[model samples]
Target: MTGHRLRHAVRRADLPAVAETRRLLRDHLRLWGVPAMVDTAELLTSELVTNALQHTTGGAVLVATLSPGPGPRLRVEVQDSVARRPRARVVALPEDHQGTSGRGLFLVETLADAWGVTAWDSGKVVWFELSDPRK
Candidate 1:
């Protein structure tokens, strides 16, 4: 698939919209015979979108871009109007059932081949790219 792109914009109140975005990516990846990554992609998208919804105010724009080159990659961008850059807090790993926090970015880091943040004049976008299993 050359020049493939998928974009979605939804308010925080629209939770189903988020799930639909994930499903769209899952379907596209399935068509590309990368079904193995569907679940991970969906989960990652969910987390990113959820973070944006919880942290921002205006809305969230979830963009799924398929980049074809030497190797294919699925890129997801979640834009938010929040002023702060999405930062990952390093937390101590424990085996007990103590309260924990700030693991969303950690989960993204664990699953994404590459992940980072891009700051815009108005806000920022937290993005993650997963290698296309087909490639």
Candidate 2:
């Protein structure tokens, strides 16, 4: 690849893959010398991956890329075979909150510098980006 990019595949909606995904991202971030982004990047990635696994029938492809610049950009995308979009629910009351069932995208929105969904012919990709603050 021309740039720093790492791609991984999850066989199915396997929840265990989330931990593996985090480990891979952590190693890459360490190699890229952006340890500061590891926490947010891993958390957001877990959310996206979990959402994809829970909502989609097929597996997901995780694409992580680094864009070099004055401020390096780290983007993590989870692509799955589902056309449905994701929405963040407003937790109005404490009782409205379920047992961590619906807050994935909300965390992504709060932490990511920018995030959006891209619809493809086969499915859709949920992606979020985090810029290196040290830059």
Task: Specify the highest-TM-score model's number.
Answer: 2
Clashing pairs in 2: none
After TM-score superposition, the amount by which residue 110's alpha carbon in candidate 1 deviates from its true location, in angstroms, is 0.7
- 1-135: candidate 2 lDDT, tens digit per residue: 135888999867699989999999999988987889999999999988887888888889999999887788999999999547544433333555766677777788778999988887777899999999787
Local error of candidate 1 at residue 135 (angstroms): 3.9
lDDT of 1 by residue, 4-114 (tens): 777888786576677777878888877765677788889989888877877776678988887777577888898888556645543545566355556677788888999
- The number of clashing residue pairs in each candidate reads 0, 0
Off by over 4 Å in 2: 87-98
In angstroms, give how far residue 79 of model 1 lies from its true place: 0.9
TM-score of 2: 0.87
